[model samples]
Target: MTQELVAQLFGKALSNPILDRMDDAASLDIEGRIAFTVDSHVVSPIFFPGGDIGRLSMTGTINDLAMVGARPLYITAGFIIEEGFLLEELVRIVASMRDAADEAGVQVVAGDTKVVERGAADGVFITTSGVGSIPDGVRISGSNARPGDIIIVSGTIGDHGATILSKREGMDFEVELQSDCAPLGRLVEEMLAASSGIHVLRDPTRGGVAATLNEIAVSSGVDVEIEEEKIPYRGEVRAACELLGLDPLVLANEGKLVAFVAENDAAIVLETMRASRYGADAAVIGRVAEVESSRPRVYARTLLGSRRILSMPTGEQLPRIC
Candidate 1:
């Protein structure tokens, strides 16, 4: 069964000579400054509206590397399946991973598989680790954001979380919602090409934009202020969140990214992002400012012309919506 699963992964899309060797470890020929990232996906329904656990695991790790201004090169996957899981389902998941990898131009160089007792695990869980090469002279980090930097978000927020919540609760909204689960390597590259002044790049996944910006503020010792009206969000998703008593700012997003760039080059970066497929809805939502207190802060100016503190999420609002 393990061998069959491995063969399925290597199906037409993924053809890597190193992976075909079936070795305990993959021999990579990468050099220069490299970025390594690992992520685990355990969304409740292994299959979601726009993606599955397989695609999530792959793109999540790939996005992690891209966040640090790296070009994603290869990824490795590890899967844990519960007993009695259908072979057809596994094949479907593997196909999703292949398609994502192919789209991102990355190779799945190695993997591991394990099966457990029926009640011991979910239908399936996936862990992915990715390697990427950072270009020369590129420097990006959470702590790199500085006062006068402009903040831009890739697209509409909360789509992924809303889609998952709607699916799990069986609540259908007036408009269809799909998870923004996409590989963002290409988008990051374009942003890099547009500006060398980019200081920070982040994918708002689990805690969404609020959490990510808060982390950046603390790390960089800067205060962030954004206009609530400027942040892009689908009207249908907002309505759904209001109906469900949830906050869209804290919702998860799989494909979107938040970039902190120098004010001088903000226009070009925003232009570059808006030109990309995943970043069509890109908007400059805010700016970083000198911190007033020893502890940095994140503030959102509401549509009512009032300021409110955007605090870090204390607990997981939606469990396993990754």
Candidate 2:
């Protein structure tokens, strides 16, 4: 049955008969260093203000590969569809995926589909795996942050999480909030070109900027300090976060990135990012520091001349948020 499903989803191959075996894994031949990343999207209401699962899946995977200074090339998607899922909605998703892939200049070379009993799955769950090539002389990682490096975020935070929460909870806000679900490869490319000594590049998804910074601090064995006044947040998102007792820093962001670069090149890098479509709100929010304590920590400076520790999220503040 699975073989038949595969045949229906992907046509038969002529060269390799083993391809018809419907194996769980697919092998690929490679040359230089390759980067691979996988992500699953289960955003509530599937159809949100800015995008759906299909576009989110593509962007998420592409951005993951791009964060490490990799040029994304291809993606493989696996879809789990509910039995009663609407075919029209599925078509729309596929179209959106195509559009996203085209915009990213990546090919959807492979994919799979499976149907589950109605209640067993949500409307649809998308898993995307992407492969990209890392350019020579480019090294970027979470552990590369150094003392005196300036941190810059691509854009405003909490848009994606706020949009999802509003739609899921059916709360009407004064302004229309849209999710910042966007591809960041181009933005990363611009930043890399403007400066070569980029210490780290991280997309503040899942647990948002706070969790991302904490992860970087621990990995790089350095202290990070951010001024709350410098972090950008939309008014509507701020109001929503207040109402829900959520910190905007802890909310998820899909279209934002945190970059660590040398202090001298920070302004040029920020200018490059600001010129790009995805990074208009780019700002130098923080800096890396050598930790004197036992473990690395993230600290935020408030407007009232107070400091607070930023830690990883304890529990799911919001569920099914991409």
Candidate 3:
């Protein structure tokens, strides 16, 4: 059964010579400064509105590399399947992974699979690891934000988490919601072409924009102030959050990114981001400034002209919301 399953994945899913070797460990060729990251996707339902666990596994790792201004090059997937899981579903998931990898211009170089008792595991869990090459002169990091830097977000936030919550809870809305899961490598490349002043790049995933910005503030030892009205948001997603008493800023977003760029080059960077397919809704949400207190902090200026500190999220608003 194991051999048959491996053969199926090799024939229909993975299309790489290194992976075809069926070796315990496949050799990889990496050069220059590379970014390496890994993430596990145990999202409930296995499939969601716009993506599935397989696609999530691929994009999640790819985005992680892209967050550091890296060009995603290679990835590996490890699957844990429950014994009674349907073979058809497994094939579908692997196919999604292949499509996502192709879309990101990356290769699935290796993988492994294991099966456990039906009740011991869910349908399937995917863990993905990726390696990417950072271009010369690129120095993106969370701690690179500086005073006078402009903060930009790629697009609307909270789409992914909101979609997952609605799906898992079997909630219906007038407008359907979908996960914003996607690969951002191309967007990063385009932004780099626009300006070299970009200091930080991050995908607001688990803890959303609020959490990511807070981390950047602490890491860069600077304060961040965002205008609530300036932040892009989908009306339906925001409404969904409001209905559930969830803060949209604290919700997860798989496809969106928050970038901190030098003030002088902020306009060009924002313009460049807006030109991309995934970043068509890019907006300048905030700015980095000198710490006003003994420590760095994040603040949001509401539409009513009231300012409130945007604290780091204490926990996931929707758990297993990859």
C-alpha lDDT of residue 24 in model 3: 79
lDDT of 2 at 254: 86
Instruction: For residue 239, give model 2's deviation from the true position in Å.
Output: 1.2
Q: lDDT by residue for model 1 over 1-322, one digit each (tens)?
A: 4646645554444557878877889999987999998888899778888998888998899999999999999998888889788888888888899899989999999887788888999898889999999999999999999999999999999999888888775554545888999999999999999889999999999888999999999999999999899999998789877787788999999999999999999999999989999899999999999998768999999988998999998777753332
CA deviation > 4 Å runs, candidate 2: 1-31, 170-175, 318-322
Which lDDT values do the candidates have, in the order given? 0.89, 0.84, 0.89
Clashing residue pairs, backbone N/CA/C < 3 A, model 2:
none
lDDT of candidate 1?
A: 0.89
Tell me the tens digit of each residue's lDDT in model 2 across 1-322.
Answer: 2435533433332113333444665565555788999998887889988998888998999999999999887777888888778766876777788778778877776677888888999898999999988878889999999999999998899999888888875555555899999888888888888899798999999989999999999999999999999988899999888787789888888888999999999999999999999999999998999996889999999898898888888777753333
TM-score, ranked from best to worst: 3, 1, 2
Error of 1 at 268 (Å): 0.2
Residue 198 lDDT (model 2)? 91
Least well predicted 10-residue stretch by lDDT in candidate 2: 10-19
